[model samples]
Target chain A: MGIKQLAKLLADEAPECIKEVPLKSLQGRKIAIDASMSIYQFMIAVRQGGSNNPAAMLTNADGEPTSHVQGFFTRTIRYMSEGIKPVYVFDGKPPNIKSGELVKRREKREKAEKELAAAKEAGNIEEQDKQAKRLVRAGTKENNDCKKLLELMGIPVVNAPCEAEAEASALCKNGEVWAVGTEDMDALTFGCPVLLRKMTFAKSGKENIQQMNYKKAIEGLNLTHDQFVDLCILLGCDYCDSIKGIGPKKALAFIREYGCIEKILENLDRKKFTVPDDWVPNEKKAKEAEEKEEAEYDTDEEKEKTGKPKSDADEEDTEEEVVPIYVKARKLFNEHEVITNLDLKWKECQVEALTKYLVDEMGFNPDRVKSNIEKLQKAQKANTKPQSRMDSFFKPLPSKAGAKKPAKATVGSKRKANDTKGKKGAFFKKR
Target chain B: MFEARLTQGKIFKQLIEALKDLVQDANIDCSEDELSIQAMDSSHVSLVQVNLQAGGFDHFRCDRTISLGFNSTNMSKILKCAGNDDVITLKAEDTADALTLMFESPGQDRIADFELKLMDIDAEPLGIPDTEYQCTIRMPSGEFQRIIRDLQVLGDTCVISCTKEGVRFSVSGDLGTGNVLLRNNAAEKEEDQVIIEMEEPVELTFALRYLNFFTKATSLGGSVILSMSPEVPVVVEYPIEEFGHIKYYLAPKIDDDA
Candidate 1:
């Protein structure tokens, strides 16, 4: 759950921050798409049959999962036809801070696997369908498959150093893309200038493309970017545990009042909030030494079981540090590792190779592949012409700061104002 | 064990009604002397603190101090089951997961018992420093409620200015500006009096939205107290005769346009 209930909170509290734009409006924009998130969605949505049928994972002849390819291929074609240049960002190694969350996900997957087996044994179709969806994991294979597919289509694919969302946000910040496209709200926490949600939506006509303006959001909420990130962390993020009782509304209040997690934690009542035991960041060097000792001690048993050398085990142990999860989480949000100096160039789709790869290797229908290839070529041809927006014709002038300055200035002096106000004998300072 | 019985059960019911909309969950701290609660509204823009003295209850017993956390909405639902004249008895163990509420009708012919699940509410107990207000304006609770309600129609924020002459509540919106002034009126009925005691003049602006919510306590008191100092949160108090008072603290909106 990336910033749980964030969309609702934004809609409720800062309606001006989100815009519902028609798909056609994005005609000449480059969007850095979170590949893993979309792939996972495809795995859930694209099944063997319709919704009424058994939700079996769609696979190629050799049982290789092809649902992601099927969904991604069609979606890319749709986006291309709309003249939207898509840059797919794939996840590399996740940050060490995410290990706990990954472990929890793995445990959940295992439990779902067991439940699926039980449901299969019981012949409960509905239960099996539910468990199957829960078991979906976009692993390395899916990532590589999409990478190859996008490469064939000449759509740029960036393999992020840690997280795809961060990489996508970085690309947007670098002005390589107009927006970061994904359902995950954490991209905003990573400071993506613009975040587009429901971009992967099937044309059901029920939903509109939600464009969230980061600047407008912070301005409307009266928060600095750092404070916004703190609010996201408080709401709930993948890299660390959130305080149990604080929901979205309360989290925003805390962030607004205290400014940062450190100040909030400093002032929080432990009896009420129940801060975790290991809330502080651990000493890295000490933790590694301790883990290395444990690894050395476990070597005898490892040697007896798998003939693995003590040196190899020690090397593996050395890599795992005991940094407090939230600290690492915040660091990742602020300064995630990405290939910053990226040279992105969208080229003509290799139609022949794409058709052969999709139709022959992926077992896609030949006629459908051919038609999509044609559509892609048509979109590419249309995109080659210089697309000039209204702003491109004129030099942008400095925005009038008169209206915004007073609001910001007042916010800056609010704490001080309150402090002096409390000095007056009649004032009641309600905590 | 902890138990407190109130003869007028409607007070408890009305109290829940006043609090439920503003607060979602809170802990009711019961001691030998009094039962108290201190909670900030979900937005933290305002706070509601309640204090009910033990002596005011028909019967009160507390072997040890206990904190009972509950969802105010759920609490309201449970309280709604009691009749207005019912004698409400609240009981809980020293370390309880739920609080038991037993309500007996005045006729003693009907009785209802509700066990409300306790929540682990994580809220810091805010320390409210005592202050002698620069100005204290006391007016009929109904009148105060009407002013807040009427001003809400005019604007989002209400500007309240108190002077030696009288107190003024003013609001300006896109449509127009509205101002209501109340001078010191010593009516035959004490509750109808508009009384103001001031050392210095002060003007403050507050969000009328929250002030309107605070007015839900109008039925609980005959008069409402408005205490204020410059640049600080104004305290709105509704006294529950012989028992306690429900106080709301709302910070004034720092005028950015000013």
Candidate 2:
């Protein structure tokens, strides 16, 4: 079947799981986008319309940031208007297993970029020249402007420690988001319970939209979540390359019959199965490694207790653990007793400090400062009743003209009444 | 659906050349059994029509009828590319907006796809005149090509005069007049130069560029025939194998000095 037909079938099979929600609700819901994937799709589509630089990075005459800025603002605003709040996650250090793919992609892009630069410098002024520029700009802008636009929209962007999509899938698994949105089918294997396939253009068409229920998907394959993980591992994941001669269907069958990784490995014929040299079972070896690691840890702790110099490895480790002083200070301030007592962690430290310093150093009453902090924090948290609070806080002291005078006007008589019995004194007070 | 045939590649080649020169508004028609195209120059005084028959292609085989809807400008662009001596195939793919042309030669094969765009060229209302006081001249394609080539050296205007005895092509400019004459069947006459004349004489002036373009059609045929009335349009026709003919119409120049 074609991609469209497959998409239709998937959509039909998974209706309730893929039911459309108001874009507003999707706001604050984490979306895991395959950065390179989405940008490439956009580039291809735009080029089909014969744009001069369909992927061209745009710049003003002065050569400031151009193409990416426009794409980011325009596309993000479009998404926002459609009620899909977007958080653009950018890729960082790729895992070692993907190094080969990264090298190939880098070489290809470098060649393209060099050609584009030459075209620009030559002043060709042809349509193809414009197209080359567009392609280059599209790539550069994909990284820079897309991130900035998300920030401007008040969306939370995460620079993943590794593959952004994988991190995003983890976010969904941890209930930090409603679903993980990406075009890659591999995201399901990454353990996202709700994998939204066409989140980017879902609003535009019902045809391409596909939603997979991770639970249902796993059930359909007749494998538990762990078995599914093993299936992907057997099929080759970034954590370990796929075992040769094993594909998705075969891997599923292997996992289903064996029930565990150890059993599957045991059942495999030794001659037929050649494990990759780097295919270390880090998770399986974790317990025994921890015990051996703990024994080494004791020697380090002993070195810390005594005044002896730490081993070279230990010193290297401490150097790694050294925290920047500003971070330390921020942590201290966050846990400060005064800040904690008043529940003002969410307030700006500058604002809180100014109010406290004014009250303490300028002889402002403690009660008044406390009340003001409460009112300010409340107003900041929820934007209601600010005017009333302002009026009350700034109201003038009672005027002398409106003060009531003492009824008897005799200090000696007051002293005699104070000396009288408690019952008579209480009655006088009531009267 | 329409089809037409040509024996030598020259007819098709010259037709393409002429179409390239004419503005796209000159609607040319083609059919399976016959092909005809007629158009007038800017002055509307001359009308040219080119016709070809199916039997001209007896050595080859083509039976399908196809009609092409094209803007003349675009059609010219599509036809400008012709491989020498290769049988060109033109077909419209089932209701598609495009037409495909294929050219085949040893180790060299090419297919050009052109989208057929519709044009709105109104047919000229002026009919071919039935003037009796006229002249007809037959001459070798090379002789006409040579005179046009020489006149182009002077400038972009030339005069043609035909009489019972001979035909004269002359161009004059700041440099001086350049003239060429072909008398009936002289001793130096080659088999290629055949001159024909009528009882009366006819003379007319035309733009060098139009004549230059008109002669290009001769590349597809051996010779061209000139039919004229003094102030009327000139009809240049090419006779190919069997009774097939391709014609072109060009208006006469209005004499400002007169």
Native-to-model Cα distance after best TM-score fit, residue B128 in candidate 1, in Å = 56
lDDT of 2 by residue, A1-431 (tens): 00112223334433323433334334223355556555554544433223443343333454443333433434554444432434555666654435444465567667777766676677544644544533442344456555544443344566666566666666666665557667765566556687776555534533344556777666556567666656555655433344677655566668779985557766877578665433423322345458667322232233244332211223222232222211221221122111001111111214455344434433445675465545434333221111111111122222222121122211112211111121211110110
Docking class of 1: incorrect
TM for every model, in the order presented, reads 0.53, 0.34
What are the candidates' individual DockQ scores?
0.01, 0.00
Please list the Cα RMSD from the true structure of every candidate, rounded to 1 decimal place.
19.7, 37.7
User: Where does the lowest 10-residue lDDT sum fall in candidate 1 chain A?
Assistant: A409-418
Interface RMSD of 1: 21.4
Top-DockQ structure, candidate number: 1
Model 1, range A291-381, lDDT digits (tens) per residue? 6764322322322443221112221344333333455567778878888768787888898889888887899889988888888887776
- Per-candidate local distance difference test: 0.79, 0.49
Estimate, for each residue in B1-258, the C-alpha lDDT of model 2 and write its tens digit: 222223344456556566555534443344444545655443232345565665565332333322233455566666556556655555443222344554444344654444444432323223343445477777777778888999889865677888765888888776888888888764355436666767778887776777777776766567788887766567777776574676666555543210
Which sections of candidate 1 miss by over 4 Å? A50-53, A204-206, A281-324, A394-431, B1-258
